[model samples]
Target: MNIDDMESLDEETRKEIEELRRITPEKHGNAFFAQAQFNLGATFIKNGNIEEALEAFSNIQHLHSPKLYAAAQYHIGEIIESNGDIESALSIWRNINHSDNPEIYAAAQSYIGFVLFEKNDIEEALLVWGNITHADAPEQYVQAQFNIGICLSEKLNKEEALLAWSNITRLDDPELYAQAQYNIGSNLLERKHVEGALLSWHNIEKKDNSEAYAKAQLRIGNTLTEQGDYQGGLLAWCNVERLDDLEAYAKAQFKIASFLISFEYKQAAIKELQLIELMDDAEAYAKAQFNIGILLGKNSDIKGAVKAFRNIKYEYDSSAYGNAQYRIARILISNNDLTDYTSAKTCFELAREVFSYEARSYIRILELLEVPETKSFGLSLLDLLNIVLDIVDILTLNFSKYADEEKPFERKLAHYTSTYTSNLLLGNDKNNTRPSSFRLNTINNVNDPSEGQLLIRKLKDVKDNSFVPLAFDKKFHAFISCFTFNHDSLNQFRLYGKQDNKEASGMSLVFKKDFFQSKNLIGGISYLSIDNTLKITEAISNINVKESHDIQGQKIKNENDDQELVRRSVMRCVYLDPTSDYFHLAQRNRLTFFREFGDNIVIKNGTKQSQAEYEWGVYQEYIKIITEKFEVAYQILKTTYKEVETEINNVRFTLGSLKQKELAILVDEILLPLKYLIKHSAFREEQECRMIYITSIDRPEVTMEYGSFLYVEYEPSVKDHLDKIYIAPAALQHKRYFDNILKNVDVPVEVSGNVFR
Candidate 1:
């Protein structure tokens, strides 16, 4: 009967249980009764009532059914194990092994082995497992073999354990075969037989269609990396061709990239990283990009590197974001290009808000870049003003809107006024240059608006003596002008203001004092500022004069005259022009000024009578002065310029520094077309000559040093100027200039004729 129609008896469920037991023997026979008791015991075991389950299982011994009795015994072992009775559990499991049913026998054997393993009787566990060697044994028997392998491996008997696991591959079950192969590889790995382990793991892929193969591939790759075979490891990882498992694939790719970097194959690492298919995972992609940036930065590609680093979001991972921000700022500092200074400053400020580790260094970088310290200081002032303004604006707006409800407004005003007074009192530092504390007090609502406004007005009226003049000196002007003109000519100069607005733009030049002293040079342009009138102004007033004037005393006249020339060198000088195009005018003026003082002009020896000997000496001397005046500054600038050029050249270097196989790939894929294009151009003949020179240099072993190991004798048809010259060891002598030519020329050349062909 349904429960609703059940008898009105107070113990309905109890009566039902008794009725079920009464009919069970007749309805299901003795075997069914035993099975029913076992099932009820299993329910108790599932419900965590182990004692009740054991009591129910004990009743099966009274039943006359062999299969049911075996099941009950097996369940009793499980219940005893759950209750932490190891000896009793083992006894119950061993009893099941004597049962006549094959399935029950296999199950019992597995449980007995597990019990022995837990008891630390590994040998006995293996002995129990070894009894299940029949070919027709259930999959549980194969699983037992795998377990024995694990125990043997733990005992350090890896080889024999691997053999035991290998026998599992003969099982027809695909899952069992995969597990066995994996176990064998694991054992081999413990013994440091990396290749053997990899081979066994690879067999899993061949035998299994499950994720077991993917896991095996990852293990094999890790093993190869541990053994220092990075390339092999990467190749093994690439064997996981499962595009559906993009996360795993991306992880493998990242590992490969990290491995390549460790081996100093950065370009290869970047290439491998780019091949990862999962670009959607922002964290992984950002990490990969960040690593690429670091690699580029280490290799001196600062700008590209900074861009990569700066692309990471602040929200990704705070630590990683902070690190990327720090790197970006550092690269900006090293850039020497002031174009990014403002942005760098902003980035640093943002970084300060989230992380302070890089804040001070960023501040120092800004200081070096000459960003007005007042800019940051101004922010404090503005913050103070904003706070007062916000309070006043809110109070006024709310009061006007809700005059009828004046209580809340009046209370807010009282609170704001109190805060303002407290801040103002604390901010009262009369002697400091920056009213920073005062400003912070206002922003923190520690000062009244009127007092803060008065203080700000006084600060503004104080001449902002905060705006320090650029340190203009005679040497500074000369260096600045020269640096501006030369760097601009090289297409490397970037001014501070509008590109076409020359008057708004300012130029800076730096020098090192040690360089000047070493080179015996003086005078360089340091800084140049153009006013609205377009007049070029110098930062320094006094020009340096040479201590010794002996060199200044002597001079030579034009070619046809032997007259002693008058020395017209000026110790200090300034050239100024008010023209709109002052840079062009300044250039012309400088040319005239040096012409008037011929001794100051650099001279180079050439066919032209006006050509001077060693003009580089004068240029080097000019560079020396600037180097001296601003040693650290100029060095930083020089390094940055060099870095930029290096970055541009790095792409070429990547292909250029290739090994044999890599070089072959590049030549076949890239160089051949380049050669073909050059062959069809006007440079063909020149290219042919260059190609010959390159070929000759390429085989360096065949070309000995011209002077040290080999000698050349030349008898010119018109060398009458050299026929009688003595080859003196201590005086003027006629010596071949081959070494000099080689030292000066960038590209290799041969003297086919009087001309360098």
Candidate 2:
């Protein structure tokens, strides 16, 4: 049977017939067997029995002969083409086209063109179809030309489309010729040749009873629209709608909306969009809602805009939903007249939940509302003012619970106040009060705790607009004592000395200076000089007999020793002068001492002897005489000896003399001790002797004139004796005794200050 006969079978019956053909034996030789099978497969293909037809062709391949194989392959290609397996069909056709069988080769070439045309390979398809130059070429070749024209027209190759279609127009089939004319109209429309498009489309006979006539009318209208004729465009779209296609209607509504929007008639555009909304397409509804929201927002009807935006669901319109929520929150914040903080907060919260990644601006809005000033605004406007207050109280209480944790309520309060103040300043609202400067003094009077109860009481009376004062009752003197000591040693020196040694010691002396009256030394001595000569004789005899003997022996046995002692004694006078003019005289004495000594009497003894005998005795005795005499003379001349003695003790007179401008006195008086003990409970070595001189030169004319004399002598035989003679001033002698004992005990110095206590 031929393909035309196979087309008459029902699809199921044709499949069964092809299946029977595959299993049944051939009635003739190989050539006839192949031919019969090929015919059977063609019939299956025409009836859409592709699977069964493939099986029939597989049986033909078993012959193994090239001529038979080529014929079988050609049949397979035709079946594959009918089945719409274009790639597989092309492969099979290529194999047959190379075969030696002329009939098989021609059939393969014709089928190849059909497959290529199906793939939209118009050029290759037309090339293959053109090889069939004979008038008797198969009907499949005629179909290939028509398909090529459709492909060319779709790609806007107008000339090529016309040529392919014109070739098919020569066919005898009236249906095929109508299709070619319709495709030529499409090609001219794509090229924007409106006159040619109308001509080609009008060439199709509407009476032919095909879909081509309706399509041609649509094309002609669309061509007019492409030339900037919107009325014509709508008419073409109306033609498609008249055909009762829902997709075309929806598309037409969308196109009208887009066109209106492009023309800057947004309101008119929205009306067209409403048509799409009525159509119930969810995507279109979402877009229409967003556009309406934008239009309303632009018109500043923010509430209406927000309602429109919120109409969109989150899933279908997340971006628009988030944007709409943000807009509502921002508008509410800016309006301020609404003052509905609750609604504002809700809007922002919903915005953050829906679009967490882009919610920072919305979050800032909520934060600003929570500030005390804005919250006050909400309290004023909100009908549920009590509930708002209750919530704030609860938050404040909860916030205080973590006040001592990582984030403190005090710090947060400070931060909030600052933020509120900054925002108020930025808004430049005159109703908002500027933040006041912090008044720390209101909290505590004295900057530190060292102030006494007097300051504390003052602090208690002081109050500020913010913060309460704290009163501290107990004295802070105890704390002060932690860093300070009574300094009993320093106090003793202050009280007993004729002139507070602090003044003489280069420290500020705080004493009632008026209590001790100054007096002329000459007048005092004159008043008490009924026995001045006797007093001098007594002072000279008071020098130790042994010390006097040693002095004489040192002077007679060594001229150098004698001269050095004289030089040092004279040099001591320089320190006595407040003006220090005697320094030149002292230097001359020093040179005389060095020249006379000249390495004799052992140079080592010079320093030791000067420090011990001469420095401590004559030098110190001269200073002591001056100090004592001055005190005594002052008392005798001013008050009386008994009255002065009551105020001061340990005074003795040494020498006195008169100068041109002033009367000078050398006196013996006890000064602070310069004594230290051997440490570690260890006695000083027998060869080590410690000596201290408790006297100084006193010159009222100059400050810092009085100083203690100290000397240490190391001599095994006289070491103990040296200690006894090295008495300290009556004021600080005990301190020296304790310091010596403690040092000998090897107690650490850190504990020395507390040792006596």
Looking at model 1, which ten-residue stretch has the lowest summed lDDT?
Answer: 686-695
Where does candidate 2 stray beyond 4 Å?
Answer: 1-75, 78-91, 95-230, 242-247, 257-272, 277-286, 289-757
Q: How do the residues 262-326 of candidate 1 rate in per-residue lDDT, one tens digit apiece?
A: 56899999887666543534555566667778788788787777777776785653334555675
TM-score of each: 0.36, 0.31
- Ten consecutive residues with minimal summed lDDT in candidate 2? 566-575
Total residue pair clashes for candidate 1 = 35
Which candidate tops TM-score?
1
| Model 2 Cα lDDT, one tens digit per residue, 33-125 | 665666666666676767656776766764535676787777777666666777887887787634356556656776777566556676787
- Compared with the true structure, all predictions reach lDDT values of 0.42, 0.38
Which runs in model 1 stand beyond 4 Å of their true positions?
Answer: 1-33, 39-56, 79-91, 100-102, 112-137, 186-195, 206-209, 217-237, 241-248, 255-287, 295-333, 337-757
- What's the CA RMSD for each of the models? 33.3, 48.1
> In candidate 2, residue 20 scores what lDDT?
49
Q: After the best TM-score superposition of candidate 2, give how far the Cα of residue 388 lies from its true spot, in angstroms.
A: 37
